[model samples]
Target: MKLTVLGCSGGIGGARSRTTSFLVDDDILLDCGTGVGDLELDALRAVDHVFVTHAHLDHIASIPLLIDSVGESRRFPLTVYGSPETLRILRSHIFNWLIWPDFTAIPNRHRPFLRLQPVKVGECVRLGERAITALPAHHTVPALGYCLDSGAGKLVYTGDTTYCKPLIAALNQTRNLRHLIVETAFPDEQHGLALASRHLSPSLLGAMLDELEVSPQVYISHLKPGVGERIMAQIACYAGRLRPRALVHGEILEF
Candidate 1:
């Protein structure tokens, strides 16, 4: 299976888009962002399931647009998976009539285009030939990281999180972790703000990596716009004994 970096920036700007990533062939979307519009209609249509980490706007704002774009041609209900609190925020706040039209009840409510599924922590959910297990993370709201086990190799995607014990522990359980896609949203100079917002800075991310016993190829993403250079340099400085690289849009990895 191959994973595509649809969008990986922390915020939007020139050459940088919000957070969205896709596991191709599997039809599993890690997150949906404004950048999702870049995908062709046929590509968007192929998406069967979307697993959200939390209810943050950057991560889920494009769900409404995506479903709306698919419109009448959508034959099956799009499955939206997330934690209970995350689902609640999406349903009661984002997908509710206030922020956006609730597609889950659109098209006569009986057979709507969207289906929300709440996935609890540690539970493994089937996604075609693979199984995704939800792992815990440190974020402002209820958040989760996912480990996709395809039997061939495991791929872990840490949605948006700070350095946490559970995250390190989860990575330790996997034997053949092919790729580790984590986030470092800011430079070490912004550690205070990063910690306050429950995001990782370069220094924090490096310390987190020291806990890992496995040697998965690390791909760092979610750098704030215009600061990628500074953040990347700091991350590289402390990347000793670990293989790490900054993630770019269109970067594809197969396992």
Candidate 2:
């Protein structure tokens, strides 16, 4: 399977910088961020499932707009998968009519425009030959990383996280892990702020990498737009033997 990077910045500033979002093949979305807005109408309609990492606006900015744009044209409801806490937050704040219309109940409940599925850590959801599993994450909000196994090879996306041992353990156990897309949100100078915000800095990321057993093609993503250069330079010094390159806006990874 091929995974396309739609947007991978932690925050947006210019035309090329967009918040986190990734498209797996053509049918699945890892997170529907601002980058999703760049897709054509038919490309938007092609998405059948969205697996959300958390309830953060930067990660889910396009869900409401996406559903409104193509929900009526689709033959089936758009499925959005998330953790229980994340879903509760969306229902309470986002889809509660005041923020955005609850498409889960729109056009009659029996055949609504949207569907919600709650997935727990360690749970695997299969779609045809693809297996998408929710991995552990430690962030400010309820969050999850994912491991996508395409039968032959695997790719792991560690959606916004701090230093968490469960994540490292899970990664070490994974087989055929071809690509690992991870986040290093801040530079080493902002280590204190990064810890407070439950994000990873260069030092923290290196510490995690030290425990890894699998040597995948690591690609660093979700850096704060302005200070990406400094963070990456620090990563070069601290990130141990695996020299992970920065993940670009439109980069694609096939596994």
Candidate no. 2 TM-score: 0.99
TM-score per candidate, chains pooled: 0.96, 0.99
User: On residues 53-123, what C-alpha lDDT tens digit does candidate 1 reach at each position?
Assistant: 88888888788888888856888899899999999988898788888888888886789989999998899
**Which is the leading candidate under TM-score?**
2
- For residues 176-237, write the lDDT of model 2, one tens digit per residue: 99999999999988999999998999999999998998989999989998899999998888
Q: Cα RMSD (Å) between model 1 and the true structure?
A: 1.3
- Model 1 stretches with alpha carbons more than 4 Å out: 16-18
Q: What is the lDDT of residue 136 in candidate 2?
A: 95
Worst 10 residues of 2 by lDDT: 235-244
* Clash pairs, model 2 backbone: none
